[model samples]
Target: MGRHSRKGPKSSGPDIEAATADAGADREAVRPVPGTGRRRRSVEAPAGSDGHTPFQQTGHVRGGHPEQREPGGGWGTGLQQLHRGDDHRPGARPTAQQQAAAGRQQSTGTRPLVPGPRREFVDAFDAPPAPPAPPAPRGPSIPPPRPADPSTSVGERDEQPPGGGTDGPAPAKDGKGAKGRTFTGIAAAAVTTVLAVVVAGQVTQDNGGGTTSAQPSGVDRLGPDGASRSDDRPTPEPVRAKPLSYAQKMAKAYPLAPELKASGKFEAVPGTAKAPGRGHRYRYRIDVEKGLGLDAALFARAVQETLNDDRSWAHDGAMTFERVSTDDPDFVITLASPGTTGEWCMKSGLDTTEDNVSCDSAATERVMINAYRWAQGSSTFGPDKLFAYRQMLINHEVGHRLGHDHVSCGTRGALAPVMQQQTKSLNIDGIKCRPNAWVYPPS
Candidate 1:
């Protein structure tokens, strides 16, 4: 009996022998299979026994080798042999048979064999060739051309390179084309900025002063020192008239007849003069009757100066007087014609028509100063004494307003009281007295 006689019945005689021979040859041709612990043994036919092979009862195919059988023994074992057949040396080329086997495996929808470790083979016939290196530049390298402006029409865009090739517009030499446009844009902006600054400066100059001067008018051709002047020289200030001095105001006589009747309408002198000292202050307004031909400003000035004099009612800081135009004043000192003065004084039951004199209208806010007495001097205090006479008149009338009454000189020849009706006469009951203009007359 054969060595397999104890194992199983041998079914097919010739087929089993042929399959056993092929399986033995395959085991010798390759390394051991990865997972299987034992190798396949050859099954011999039993001598003088039935013809069925024992492997047939084990489900092994009759004519096929174990590697060619289904599943567990056939296809899986074939794949392992394919992997083992590859040469695993570094950089070794794959054999033509190996590549053909891999292609065949792929074509059959089988997984392609993975090469073993340390084997790195590339199929030269299948891999693409390496690209050639770019050519060196002929001369100086040029910068790439700038993109065409989207705003430009196709015809206006840069022409193609010579020979009509699809190369970009020819590169600019030294990048001067792009640099020139950049420089031009910068220059234009700088010029625009300068112009804007110039215009703004001109506008500021014009607005600084209330008026604009194309060329300076009324300019002096020469300076005060007689040097020749250029047109660019600063314009000269206007020539203003010098203000009148106190003596000049005093010396000037205004024209108004003693009996001249004026329009009774009066206007308050427009200004304010603050009292000069810390004293009991009395605020007063000065009003001049219209058409009196008097210098109202001069009269207002005289009243302020006189009342504030050290010898007058404001003596020794005992009292102060402020002249105002707008506020409610303690009293309004009015310079009016004799008719207006007499009319105002009559309201207080004082008959001033007999002497055409000024009076304090006790019944009203006005303290009237006769324009005739103010403009023309009285016979008692003649024209040469006009300045003193005017002062006396103002003091006497204002004194009455301050609650003083008529009084006369007691001595043979003494300065009359400022409250005296000095305009009528400097004498009372046959005794003559000198003129006085202040309550506290100078010693």
Candidate 2:
């Protein structure tokens, strides 16, 4: 290759120059440069052109370097490539303020040089104040108190004397209010106890004193001879004879003695009217105070009904009712007789010679009821209810007549027939006595 280069160097230079001239002549002959008049602008704006000026060929400017005088603003092509897709545009360049900020950051090496937390943006106008150090906690505070005996708290001490009061000489009061309340409560309890004891003692005295003091019975206690005649009252009563008989026809109509055959004894008795009535078997004797408290016929009917209903169950007998107008029998069926006249009845051959008629013990038969009590608001229960009540009363008396002993349910429930001691335990108001609610079985 060295030998071939030496043979051609001088000669080959002139020949190559002649061929280049010929090729230039040929290109000149093929294409001529245009004589330009008006030039069309480029369509796309120049890169980094700030989106304003039309695209200009910077080369057309006479004697000007195109790169130095390019139609651009903000930042240039190098920045556009470097910061591609960033919010800062492609050719955007840093302002003096940004350059200063960058210089400061570089000097600080990016480590936060602030001694503590940076102030908020609002605190930027003022110098940052030093942070306050946390306060040390103090122990619970208490003032020095007045001295007391080491052995006891203030409450352990007694209350101040009345005259001494609570001056400097007195100790602090801790349980003063509590002590007062305690004393007050104890005194009240003691007073209550004393009152209870006194009441109990009085009650005992009332019960224990055997004698029932005489309550004056307002009557003539002296006779015409001026001698005490408490037991010397004239007595005269003899009623017309009434037959020992079956009950009246009305009584039989309502089965007044239905249990009579069952128990082999009579329960529903014939009640005499206030006036004599015609009947075949017995001439009815009229007693002045005969059917007193209740509708005597209706009362008798209820008793009959109860006897009839329970005959198959208990076989209890009917009970007899009589009057206390003629003379007192074994049990006095006394009525509520109210008058100033002194007589059982004028027709019954009894004397009407006293100021006030007393309970005619001689005319008494068995039971007594205050008719006035019934006439008043003694029972608010209606006819049927009263019938039930009267039936209860009859059942009570008949229970005794039937030789059934009184019994207590001990637990609360309906009244049992055997529990029929009327006056002894006649507390119907306190206990329930409905039909199905009976506590004990039917006798």
Q: Cα RMSD (Å) per model?
A: 29.1, 39.8
Q: Global lDDT of each model?
A: 0.66, 0.33
Q: Which candidate number has the best TM-score?
A: 1
Q: Candidate 2: minimum summed lDDT over ten consecutive residues — where?
A: 1-10
TM-scores for the candidates:
0.45, 0.22
Measured with C-alpha atoms, the lDDT of residue 331 in candidate 2 is: 44
Clashing pairs in 1: 10-52, 10-53, 10-54, 11-51, 11-52, 11-53, 12-52, 12-53
lDDT of 2 by residue, 1-443 (tens): 00100111111233334433543543421111111112223122222223333221111211211111111121221111112232211111122222233234334544212223223423654757878989866733223335543332233223323322222222224457556756766776776787788778778766755544354777445656988675576666787787523233212222111111111111323454321222211111222243232345444443334433433113332223333223333343323333311223332343423312222223323332223322321132233343343444444444433445556434356443434433234345476333321213455
Query: In model 2, what is the error at residue 74, expressed in angstroms?
Result: 99
lDDT string, candidate 1, 180-246, tens digits: 6567667767767877887888888777645554656776556457876675578989999999887
Per-candidate clash tally = 8, 19
